[model samples]
Every structure is written in C-alpha cells, then in structure tokens.
Target: MMESYLELKKRHQKEVNEFPFGFAFSPAQFVEMMRKWGLDYEKDINKIVSIGNGGYVQKKDRDNMHEMFSRHRKEIRDFISADESGEEFVYKMFLREMRNYGYGWTGDPKDTLEALGLTWEDVQNNEKLLNGFNKASEVALRKVI
Candidate 1:
C-alpha cells in the first residue's frame, strides 16, 4: 500500500518543518526518503518518486503536493534566491521549468527551454521572463519534507 501524507509527515517530522535548510535534503535524498518510507522502489521502479524522472504518484497526492507548494511559494523562492554562488538565476530557471509541467519536474529543465522556443542563451538574456516564471518547484521539492 502507498504511504499517506500524514504518515510521510509523521515519519519525517523534523525534515518537513525545517525544509530547504537544517537537514538540507537533496532531490536524491528525497527519493531515498520515500524508499525508506515503505514504497517498493526496487520492485516497482516505474512508481519510484523522483524529480525530473517519469515517476508515478497518485493524483490525490499530487494535488495535495501542489497545494502545499503553492502555499509556500514565497518561502521557497526566497530560499533559492538567497544562494550566494551567483547561480540563483539558473536555479530559478530550473524551478520555472518545473512550473511548466504542473509544477512538477518531469524532465530536464532544458526541455522547457526548448518547448518555449528558447535556448539557454535566451534564458540567460531575458531577466524579465525568468522573473515571470511562477515559483512552483516547491511542489516536487517539499514532497516528503
């Protein structure tokens, strides 16, 4: 059986409340967390939870995940913007790509760039468009957190 949101939350209570920091879970770590949560990842590789990979998640869970991310949009954006590596723009672009696909990272961010008739250079040159992309990546990001 699939794990419920409550169970996921209860299991990773610390990570959930202090997301994007403190423990600082990576996307890969997120998948591993789900695996440890009781999902048969090895037996059902197709149903594995991963960002930018064709992993299957139940519609109800997807909806809930979307809602949660929507609620924390500002916080997520702020956190990414706070990066000091001077690569915050690229990070934002990645999130923008995720936003293009129901706020989920179903594939490479470059795919979204292509879909929009853009090249990486185009994105690099267009600050306004990048700012316009909705900050929705927190959907897939904060899934287990």
Candidate 2:
C-alpha cells in the first residue's frame, strides 16, 4: 500500500524524495523497506521512483510506502547529523546509488548524474566537490581528528 513518491509529492505539493538536510535514502534503506513490505527488491524496483526520479507506483501500494517512510525517519535524521555538510551527504548517497544501480545513462535519462548536474570527473577534479568527497571519506573512514 505504499504510495508512489510522485503521488505523495502531488498530494503534498512538496518534494519529499531527499532527506530534509541532505542525502537521498540509501539503497540499503530501500532494500530494508522492501523486505519489510514483503516485496521482492529485484522484481519490484519499479515500485520505487524517487531514487532517481521518473515513473509512478500503483495506488494500492500507498499505505506501505507511508509506513516505510514513517519508520525510516530516524535513519534519515541520523544521516543528517553524520553528514554535517549537506552537499557531502548528497554526494556520498549519490555515489552509493550509482554503484548499486547502473545508471544506464546512455539513453539520456533525465535523472542521470550528468543530468543531475555532476559527473564522476567533476567529483574528482572540481575543488569544491572533491573537498566534499574527501571530507565525507574521512568521516566514513573514521579519520576525523
């Protein structure tokens, strides 16, 4: 009974896909949610669209989606606290996403990294983005001193 993100967005007239501070929901989060809802992650991926945008979910799945969001709120909150810098959080999540789901960016998808205003090279060479990546990495590695 999870609602498609688009449905929820239209209903609320707000963007609810990303965490309030930064970071999109992690793939692990989505996998856990699917498990909770007794959904097959592989077979039911279409049920999720906000991950990278596009598509819609069946109205029947609305309640389950709401339940998942309600339960996962804490995880998002934790991510905000840990990320500190919103852009770093967003980059880390986006990198995780790119690794988990092949972007298939060849089709000119509207939601590809390039379409989203970034690139792997940008992360590597752009001073601002690279610094964010380095900071996030240091935190991930527990190298903060």
Model 2 accuracy (lDDT, Cα)? 0.47
TM-score of each: 0.25, 0.26
Clashing pairs in 1: none
TM-score of 2: 0.26
Q: Give lDDT tens digits, candidate 2, residues 10-29.
A: 44434345322112266776
Summarize candidate 1's per-residue lDDT along 84-122 as a digit string, tens digits: 442344345455455555445343456666644456676
Number of backbone-clashing residue pairs for each candidate, in the order shown:
0, 9
Show pairs that collide, candidate 2.
1-61, 1-62, 1-63, 1-64, 2-61, 2-62, 2-64, 2-65, 3-62
Q: Report, for every candidate in turn, its global Cα lDDT versus the true structure.
A: 0.46, 0.47
